[model samples]
Target: MVDTGSANRRDDRTPVLAVAGIGKSYAEGKQRRTVLADIGFEVARGECVALVGQSGSGKSTLLNLLAGIDKPDTGDVEIMGRSIAAMGEPELTLLRREHIGFIYQFFNLIPTLTVAENLALPLELNRIPSAVRRQRIGDWLAKVGLDGREGAFPDELSGGEQQRVAIARAIIHEPALVLADEPTGNLDGRTGNVVLQLLAHLFRDQGRTLILVTHSRAVSEVADRILALDNGRLTHDTEALSW
Candidate 1:
């Protein structure tokens, strides 16, 4: 039997992710425009949090800060109790490679690589043995319902199939956190729902933490908590408001 108990096994004292007083800005012309300001929150291990905002609301910027892909002008992002601000480039790269997974709206699969090759990228980067990597690739392909299509390239698959491969690629390394940016934005309603269900199943069943950024209310509802961003500031936290 699968171990459902894994969900309850996390230590409640230390959150998987913490953000404090984060601020970011960009130079537009002569003046700087703020994208995010003083954003702070924490996501507990095994919890799924949705970040909701309208277009140009800085949701994507925040996700980048969380992933160490971009730096905040002020404040710190702590993942698994370590501050990302203190890490240099190499350390940050390693941190991302080891602890963070990302799913993008574009299904960012390499056009040249087959589905299995794309799935195998993370495992290879982390130096998982070739023998074990093959097993994991096989297992995840089956899990995502793309088992026999491993040889297919990205262009050969439908939108949903490509997304399934992306999801499998994101989680196959067992990263401590997953950040999804508009995961369903590129699909139709029915396909999006299927992807969401697949994500919910994999993350919840494995006791993984997810921070999903979306504009859709229906998509936000999938999370255990919702955080709403408005005009560069955090306007609502469902956990804080007890909604």
Candidate 2:
């Protein structure tokens, strides 16, 4: 969430993404492994929520389902009241492209594309005017402190810098929801903290919704609410302190 003004925050206060009774399972040879079951939550617009759990828990799976990247075997996901299951690929693609931004722990920049090119990819795909896209690219670059390094390739950047570029790419369109999967998992603690702080600042400053998955308590503490997952179920929900 960016520093949304009071009026903007109020306008975006309604439930933007809702999840209910989501369950997913996959067969492992002859045995079925349940990845998530009956997990339910809602992320309000302009809010930051964290889902924390040990490995094998369903944090990533749940995030994927909510993001419309994966279908749930059972349960319904409603985004701002629309049924996710009812969407076809085109509708889903539109929903994701326009309303959702995803951030991965490992920066997944295109190896061959420069930082600026990567950031503009989504907007260009959506057919935004070049002038608007260029301005947005510039704004994101500035926000992430990479104004002059946009020409650099992902491999030329440090891990933290790479992740920052990833962040810029994610938020350039100002999506209603940002789903982050272990956004800091690949970095050192110090670097990870810096990434987390950047995320926190974005949520606070931009007023976009964030649903982050992390195992670190330090990361979870920044969220307005923390959802703990275990063995494919959500086990805990706590409201953490705000910035």
Candidate 3:
């Protein structure tokens, strides 16, 4: 793996992510519609935060901003103490490649690539040595309980298995932060619970910080803290309030 050096120098007391006075809106012909208003939060190292919101409550938008996938109209988003809005496109791309990992609801594995290849993509991008990459691929496959399925394609696996591969892929590169969007939404209830349990265990064991966007109360309950969004506003939810 490429030695970014930043992680080693980071203080554990510093938050992995910080967002301040963030706001976003979209132009709708002659008018603009606000999606998020004055949104703000901090996620410390190894903390898992769940973002719960209604369909249009802007949970995805907030996540996009945090990932630097999209920019907010106002305020700032900082990851590892660097402002995302201050980075150029190339810098943002590099930031994402080196610092952020993403998990999607649909198990966004490449249909054409084998499981090993899929897991190796991030390591390859980060210029990890081929030997180490192979070892990590084997190791993560075992961690996610997908051993011996290295040559299998995405379509060949069950939903839970595919998601397990996705989870391993997201984390194998050892990113500082992980963004999960409805990670278990595509699976059956029993399978989803099992996957969730595995995800929580692996992340906690590795001490990786996570911000998950989920609609299910059961899913959100796994997080250390839950933040609720409604009508473009955010609130800390101790009760894990339902929409």
The lDDT per prediction is 0.92, 0.87, 0.92
Kindly list the per-residue Cα lDDT of model 2 for residues 1-243, writing each as its tens digit: 676697576656658888888899999999999999888887777889988889988777788788887999988998866899988989999999988888998899999999989999889877889999989998888888888998999999999999999998888887888889989999999998998899899889998889989888899988999888889988888787632
Question: For candidate 1, what's the RMSD?
Answer: 4.4
Model 2 / residue 217 / CA error / Å: 1.1
Q: What is the C-alpha RMSD of each candidate to the true structure, in Å?
A: 4.4, 4.5, 3.9
Select the stronger candidate by TM-score from 2 and 3: 3
**Between 1 and 2, whose TM-score is larger?**
1
Error of 1 at 151 (Å): 0.9
Worst 10 residues of 1 by lDDT: 4-13
Stretches of candidate 2 above 4 Å error? 1-13
Give per-model TM-scores.
Answer: 0.93, 0.91, 0.94
Q: How many times do residue backbones clash in model 3?
A: 0
Put down candidate 3 lDDT per residue, 111-215, tens digits, no spaces. 999999999999999999999999999999999998899999999999999999999999999999999999999999999999999999999999999999999
